[model samples]
Target: MSFTSDQAVEALRAAGEPTRLRVLTLLAGDELSVMELSRILDQSQPRVSRHLKLMADAGLIERFPDGARVFYRLSSDLAARRLVDMVLDLLEDGAADQDHVRLEEVRREREAEAAAYFEQVAPRWDQMRSLYVCESAVEAAIERAAGPGPFDRVVDLGTGSGRMLTLLGKKARLCIGLDLSQNMLNIARSNTAKAGLDKVELRHGDIFATRLPGQSADLVIVHQVLHYLIDPAAAVREAARLVAPGGRLLIVDFAPHALEQLREEHQHRRLGFSDAEIAGWLREAGLATSAPIALPPDTEDLTVTIWTATRAETAKRSVA
Candidate 1:
């Protein structure tokens, strides 16, 4: 997998520009669309897109298509990542201050939007969970699908009410729950404290770019989170990056359905996901996936689907 002289030169040339370097630094934080990049850079869409396309071609970044929109992030390739790291290290102090400031502004705007949504829904979040299926049944299925564990570390991405941590944290030496909503994190904190789970830590975080080290968790859970994301597959890829060798990723979400009302009423970006879609994402993320288990609803409710995948015992790679 060594890069040839020509490939190395091409990569350097691709990353040599100031704008492209700024783009790399921005993408180092989170995946962003062309529009977002343009806004942050105060550049035209076509200009931003050309930079992205060149970097992608040079393997300096990765592009993921979500419907009509495409998101870009730092390349997952090891050599490309190393090159990015070297470039970042060479940046002058305060060189990226402006970009960082604008990034924070964008983040605040996103936080405000999410806070408003969660404020409206926080009181009824758990109640809505009940409307889908029997809580006990779903919890049991999650436990069985996640399997028995004496894991070293566990992380729950988009932990809404801290239910998964309260249920599964006991088996792990340490458990961390991440959420973007301050209200949700507050509820999670209160719930975890009530459950007497002192090892559980809740943090306000972006799921696509958590502070945790790559391949650091023995068990990673993303319960009922995918439907809300603009790019669920990219989120899955992020979660997979956290799985240590021999670690497992357990995802609990709704099976494919035609719940159009959920989009308008609940801010659901997608109705549900098919098994094939979930499996394809897992496989693409370099995990060995199991056949998805479906828990049918008793009435006219959404069917819950559980998928579990394990990182290879000997595999060790970082995801960007």
Candidate 2:
């Protein structure tokens, strides 16, 4: 994606302002709302938004409206992205010490809000998710990633509503679902029972330390769960550990986005995740990952991604 002379000049000119440069620095850390930027910069909303509009117009940044709020991030365009990166690299870290400190404060506030929101909305989790992304499409994609598995054992981490259990239960001889919320587990129990999967087992357990034996399951799934965790990579490693030799791990979550309202209203610690980030974690756990499949929404909502990874069959042969 080579930048034309005009595009390069516009981007450089848009980012030339001191305030706009600061905005880019903050956004380089994470996407931010105009209000957030205003607070961090001690400027009025109208004034801050003017700077954002200029940068966004020049393709130096991107603006997305998530429900009632709008957020901005560095442009996803490769040429514009490269320009921002090179320019950011030249800016001294010390120039924005106070801004970073303020950003941390905003981050903590978001975490607290998400935690409180999670407590309030645990019961209607599935229905809420259905409002965001089409479940049928995501489920079909998940089933495809899972393939035909008369698996010996299957494990589902953060199994809210036991939807995964119900979807995969009939295919497994032993099915286990673990979650930190007993209330959610209860909901899962009722859902799985309604599906006539009486043999399915539900446990109130932590995804980060399931305490389940390593390499115990033929299929391990972490569906729509990673975004809530403070340590998603750790959870991925834990999920990978439970995959048996030659078994598969399927992760379903949203692709990278700038949906700020989801963070404020629905307790999403992350807007979404990138392919390289998730694949890197799987690789670190000694699993081979396939190219991720994305299912973009019909509207301006989130895009769901399915990542499938497998433990090498050679590992089993070697151990034997």
Candidate 3:
């Protein structure tokens, strides 16, 4: 059954229950047979099956027939996926002692798998660029924040395929691309080199806790990246941490909407953020914030927002 926004909320409320969350944590990797889940979760198969059935009916999961057994996996519903990701992220900081270790191990395994998958797929970055057509928003935000100039230090967080670096190549004295997947970084590095951006640096790292020195960048841009983060606020804080005084931070991502299907495929953290939330985050990071500018109607399902904020002069003075 297709789930709407309201249904997505209800589904999340249902799955967000304590026990049900434990079950999902175990099932995140792949479809788990009922018995396998029961063994892992230490619950009876009947009880586990009941919760799975409810999630399935809620469009949070799907059961596929494989011979005589049915395998349950995450659903393709966007809302369901977002709900799941948000719940998982929220639980990350305060999860139970036992589950925290398990979650960490699972996350490491998942990251490794995702990295490997991206590496294998890196060569196709150029072909995949056209999949998202509205790159103008990203470009506009960057230009508005940092005027055409030769910046000595710049960073593009989550620089998928390094497209933005290519755009800003001539203008940046040193452009660095940071992302989590080696494959994406490899593609980005290759693309940067291909575009003759020999000074561009590609680093595989998490946006939330990158190795880049504090207050290191003259400009930082996180384009179409925040939505994929499990904790966007943390990532924003990190971006703010890295910007030098008088430097700018630009973020372009989807705005909050009712699309629930994005979660399963896109792994979006939140549908998007409200203007107030985005502004508050920038302000907390000591940045002078502005109202989010909404993008043109491209797809009926998703809306995008771009924010440009600058570090406060006081911030620089205090750091100095």
Candidate 4:
């Protein structure tokens, strides 16, 4: 879509400032909180927030509110994203060298923090899984729910330990797993390597905004990751964005339950999702959803629910 003159001018004005430009450069790579941007830019939170607000108002960036935290990223507007790309392309070589250096430091700190948390939980991840339904049953259900596909590309969002990739990698020419924790990625890598899946790729990524292009995958799986997110619906929308035309999105998570202990013990943000909630989010994303398949636990544990949706082949809307 062509931008109006006023819109173009607004977008340009928003991108004209040096600090805002640095914000754009950093956000172009990953989603970041206002605090993180402030730390990276060596500016106060108020100052960073002001720039973010202006850019957001001008449609140059998108703000995602996740509970108490809000993350900022380049807008999904094609025109605005193209504008950002053009502006970034015009930067002098090494002009933001220090910014990049600081960004790396920030990333390392994030990695260390995430690594520590995961390290504490990694040994028990599988043990925790056993508390639910049988593993074989869940895997079979997932395989059947996803349908038979020799998909060209497959992406697993929040791919903890790369279990889904290992389970479904044979059906795809290429499979990629994305995780926020480097420790989890390491485990996933080791597991995928053990499975001898040569086409699998693992990347450190944010669930809110990933580095992959829109509608780039034939099959997208978000397995057992929603309960931990502050905004489960937003995560679903982001997962839907990765589905190609006629592609499928498979989400496996827990149904609503009174699992108060899970939150305190496991760091779960939300207890579980309801059927209506999942369906509503899928409809909002312009995907056709199938009836959810429920796998009730044999023991006294949380019930597992699998929701599948398909992106319409003729839809013109971007999955923003």
Number of clashes recorded per candidate: 0, 0, 6, 0
What local lDDT does model 3 show for residue 17?
A: 76
Can you write out model 2's per-residue Cα lDDT over 83-183, one digit (the tens) per residue?
99999899886998989999888867765675566556778987886888888999998988998989889999999788999998998898999987767
Point out where model 4 deviates above 4 Å.
Answer: 1-116, 317-320
Across 78-136, the per-residue lDDT of candidate 3 in tens digits comes to: 66777777777777654555654554555465456545655665678566544544556
**lDDT per residue as tens, model 4, 197-266:** 9999999998878868888898999998887664566788888888998899999988877767765566
Candidate 3: which stretches are off by over 4 Å?
Answer: 1-96, 102-117, 316-320
Query: What is the alpha-carbon RMSD of candidate 1 to the true structure?
Result: 6.5
| Candidate-wise lDDT, in order | 0.85, 0.85, 0.72, 0.84
Candidate rank order under lDDT: 2, 1, 4, 3
Model 3: how far residue 218 lies from native, Å = 1.5
Superior by lDDT: candidate 2 or candidate 3: 2
| Candidate 4 TM-score to native | 0.64
Better of 1 and 3 by lDDT: 1
The pairs that clash in candidate 4 are: none
Q: lDDT (0-100) at residue 180 of candidate 2?
A: 73
Question: Of models 1 and 2, which has the larger TM-score?
Answer: 1
